[model samples]
Target: MSEPKHVVIIGSGLGGASAAAALRERGYSGDVLVLGSESHRPYELPPLSKGVLLGDAEEPDWVREADFYADKNIDLRLGTTAVRIELGGRLVHDGSGGEYRYDRLLLATGSQPRSLPVPGTDLPGVRTLRTLDDSLALRSAFSAAERIVIVGAGWIGTEVAAAARKHGAEVTVVDQIQAPLEPVLGAEVAGVFRDLHTEHGVGWRLGAGVAEFAGGPDGVRSVKLTDGTELPADLVLVAVGAAPRVELAHAAGLDLSDDGGVCVDATLRTASPDVYAVGDIAAQFHPRYGKRLRVEHWANAKYQGEHVAGNLLGEHEPYLSSPYFFSDQYDLGCEYRGLADPDNDELVVRGDLKSREFTAFWVRDGKVTAAMNVNSWDDGDALQSLVDNRTEVTPTQLREADLAGLG
Candidate 1:
């Protein structure tokens, strides 16, 4: 089969921009069109919620400027939204009713923030942090809000709380779980977060779900919890989670998994040969874990973008970059490497939680399974390689030996 001559990537986020760069780097003399939904050029989103809100981060470039696309011979379309897909004809229809035929199509639409599913969610003071505009408006509201209620204890919720606290907004994190971040980080270890927030003067409402948002003319007056307690608040942030953008794929009859990602094999190819999905839209098979993984981290999008670009240009390489994710908030920064099951045994947690520097390794049945480190990148890199390589390490040795390097 001959290499595809035209590659059209939908969504100009980290994933789409990196894919275009990878395609040209691989010596693929093809037409690359990058379409972005936002009016701004492909810009980074991490800072919008965290660094930019904290006043420590400047507004940086998203990926490349508009002129950079011209320098790279890439076609850049900003403020354009892809509405639907026609698999048989291999065309992407835009919101404005424009159509473009492509030899291979990449769906990098990414994800949207999940909202609190309860009454008064439509209230004026209620907000969800996802896009640049969302963060900007939320930042403006923070200056006036006396008490801010943050629903969910995930990273985004915690990060926004940290920023709001920095802005002198009294913030409270309401979580249904026993502890903050227990769903992902495990309850035993996530205690650090509970203590971290409580000690920092951020209020906590545990074992509770939202009943409704009670509005009193100006804005939200208070948040009603499931425990029959009403917390006083002027602003609320719903950071429950994110849902992948899969409506276009679903409408086109592409197979979608329960997690809302388009199911694809290692090569990032769907059942329809001409259509390839990547970034947040693609749920790819992982041979390492022997399970299908749908990752939503920043790195996943960038790596999968490159892989789909190569696969489109006849390279046929698999998308396997070792799933990793990280979070920075308050006084803590964490980086995760490799995949780990929460049910796995033989977890080695080192360092002191009281002083906050620590690293943990997940070993399963005598092999390194997954690892997480807080401000401990060196140890994380070593353990991650072991997990990725399936290195064998006994519990006794992992506990006793210093993990500076396995070199």
Candidate 2:
């Protein structure tokens, strides 16, 4: 295959932005065009929920400095959305009635926040953190909010609860699950987050689903739980989850998985060799896990963006890096490495959970599958190596041995 003359990326978030930069770094002098629906340059989303919401960060976490795109000769079109993909013609149609031909196409459209189906969500005080603008608006609301009710006890909800509490607002989190992040981290491990939020003066209404929001013209007044309990609130955040933006891919006849993303092989190439997908919109086959995973995290977007750039240039190497992510809530900052089905994996703790400083590992068949360090920042590389190398170890070694010295 020859080097592509024109590489067009749909979506200007981190994944698309990183790919554009990586392509230039790899000496691909092709015409690199990045189309983003947002009016701003490519930025990271993690800060929107954490630093931006807390008023600690004032600017978007630009994927690269603002001048890097133009300096690298990457044509980044902000406030533009790719609405249609003509796979047969190798052309993309934007929402503004513009079409561009591409020698290679990468779709990194990413995902959108999931909203509650219940009524009153359209109220003025209701919000969902996704973009830079949303975070700024939330920051403003947090300053004046007397009570904040966050729906869904996932990462976003928990983080928002922390920020709101820091603003001196009465925060209450509602979720249908018994514990926050139970499905992903398991009840015992997820308990760490629950304890963290509780200790931070945040309230919880777990194992309960939202019924509706009772509001007036000014804004939402209170949240009504399915159990008939009414919690007064000046602001409500629906943080259930996100759905991948795959309408263009679906319309173009790309193979979509039941997981709700475009199916791609090890190299992040879709069914069509000239087309690729990454970030939240890509259900990529992980060589390490021997399965397709659609990871929705900052690390996935950053790493996959770089990995797919090589494939776009015909490198054909498989992305072997394990799934990783980090989160910061209040004073606690942590990094999580690898994928784990907490329900079946054997969990082992290295430090004290109550002390708010610990390392938790999930092992399967005597091999560490995933690990999380609550406040132990130095254990990141060791944890990554343990999971990436698939090193076998017993519960005793995991709990007692120094991770840096472990096999």
Best by TM-score: 2
Per-residue lDDT, model 2, residue 304, is 94
- Where in model 1 is the C-alpha error above 4 Å? 402-407
Write candidate 1's Cα lDDT for 213-266 as tens digits: 998667898999999999998999999999998888899999998788999988
Best by lDDT: 2
How many Å off is the CA of 403 in candidate 2?
1.8
Show the colliding residue pairs in model 1: 43-62
Q: What is the C-alpha local distance difference test score of each model?
A: 0.82, 0.92
In candidate 1, position 398 carries an lDDT of 68
lDDT for 290 in candidate 1 is 77
